[model samples]
Target chain A: MRIGELAERAGTTTRTLRYYESRGLLPARRAENGYRTYDEGDLRLIQQIRTLQDFGFDLEETRPFVDCLRAGHPAGDSCPASLAVYRRKLGELDALIGQLQSVRTEVGAQLARAELEASAELPGGPEPRCELGPTAPQSPVGPNWEDER
Target chain B: MRIGELAERAGTTTRTLRYYESRGLLPARRAENGYRTYDEGDLRLIQQIRTLQDFGFDLEETRPFVDCLRAGHPAGDSCPASLAVYRRKLGELDALIGQLQSVRTEVGAQLARAELEASAELPGGPEPRCELGPTAPQSPVGPNWEDER
Candidate 1:
């Protein structure tokens, strides 16, 4: 199919399809008029690409999986390397969850403190001391006090 | 005090102090040599700026808070606007936390499903149509299926 047809079928923009091609995630053969031609397998590949992206895998990370699909296996069992890829992605997801959870906890604590102080009617003086003390820690809030103040 | 002195006292870079001045987050007077000078109160303002930023307020959002501080509240209780600013920041933090939490849930579910599928041994041949269905929902593991197929 043509780029437009593929894009329409895949529910993505032609620009995105082009980008995937440029990133080597998709390979297309050129026709006589320089139009890109795609096989039925390309449709499956595009679906896979979309699925991986939804799962938070980047184009670079999806490359090995595309290669495996193209190789055509008689059985559903995949390459051992593919299993490793899934494991690595799982680890990354866990780390991301951990980081976000920490941010949520810290922000929740800060908001609670702010509410406490606001309700107490305590004369807001300089925070009893820096809420974040010496030795700054990484927080999703952005650059730490070490960089800010 | 000179910009350098203010930066040293505030534990911030001179460039950041200047950037804040340009952004109207900080006010400074230019001396004969065209050097920026700040007062003792500026140090407190810088500390407050850092505090707001730590709470996830961007430089733009901190403007109202800076203005409130500059207006000179008789006491911390005097600036009702400051409390509003904190409330606004709290809302933004809550939304951010909600977003991260949603993403974490989706990614965590995908990871669990991938692990389960990876460990299961499938019968050789066309995948059987089971209650779970032949076409699994598109997931990060889908693209990697190339490696598995």
Candidate 2:
């Protein structure tokens, strides 16, 4: 099969396939006509690379799996190097989640404090007041206004 | 104060100050010597921007806080617009944390399944065996090897 057919079958772009070839992750066979040709094995390798990329793995991190497949392994993760990448990715994800959770907590606290301050600056301190009063200060901002922007 | 003094007090670079001025976040006055001058209020605004940046907020996201300070608010978060930004940041952080956590779980499962498969493919299936045999296959990879790279 040609490069375009392999790319179409793998649901990826020809540019990506060329990039993989440049990176030596996918080595294509040169036909007598000097055109790049790939077989079903190349399709499986591209599919494995696409799956790992979707999981946020860097292109370099997918190399071990590609090497494993090229070495005739039934699956990309069949090699020790590929398993090592999986473990490292798990650690990175945990650290990132922890940092984001901390930021979320701090932002939530800041929002609550600001709302309290705004309420205190009002005339009645967020207490129930007569809505019919013409002189009442109407705040155009609301907690639900976050979605508007 | 001059631009240098303001940047020093704000603990940021003069280039950053100029960038902020370009963005209209910090408007500077021109002295008779044809040099840029800033006041204490500019320092306060720059401080607010830096603090939010430390919290992982984008330069554009700090605009509301800067506007709030320039509007004579006691603190950056005292304004409705700043609070809106905070609320939006919280939502974004939550979504990112959730995604990272999901990736963490998936990667953890993949690592476990791959390790189990590797052990099964080994001669003893991860069971304790005599270490005296020279013919026994040794795995060069370990879970702790993630730190070396």
- In Å, residue B140's CA in model 2 sits off its true spot by 19
Candidate 1 residue-wise lDDT, A60-134, digit = tens: 767656765665632111444445556676677666656545655665565566557655654665443222211
Task: Name the runs in model 1 displaced over 4 angstroms.
Answer: A55-57, A71-149, B74-99, B121-149
Q: Kindly list the per-residue Cα lDDT of model 2 for residues A6-109, writing each as its tens digit.
A: 88999888988887877768887899999999999998999899889888998988988887887777788888778778877888888877878887888898
**Structural RMSD, model 2:** 9.0
Question: What lDDT score goes with residue B103 in model 1?
Answer: 58
Task: Highest DockQ: give the candidate number.
Answer: 2
Error of 1 at B111 (Å): 3.4
Residue B135 in candidate 1 has what lDDT?
A: 30
Q: What is candidate 2's CA lDDT for residue B54? A: 82
Clashes within 3 Å, all models in order: 5, 0
Worst 10 residues of 2 chain B by lDDT: B129-138
Error of 1 at A103 (Å): 4.3
For model 2, give the interface RMSD. Answer: 11.7
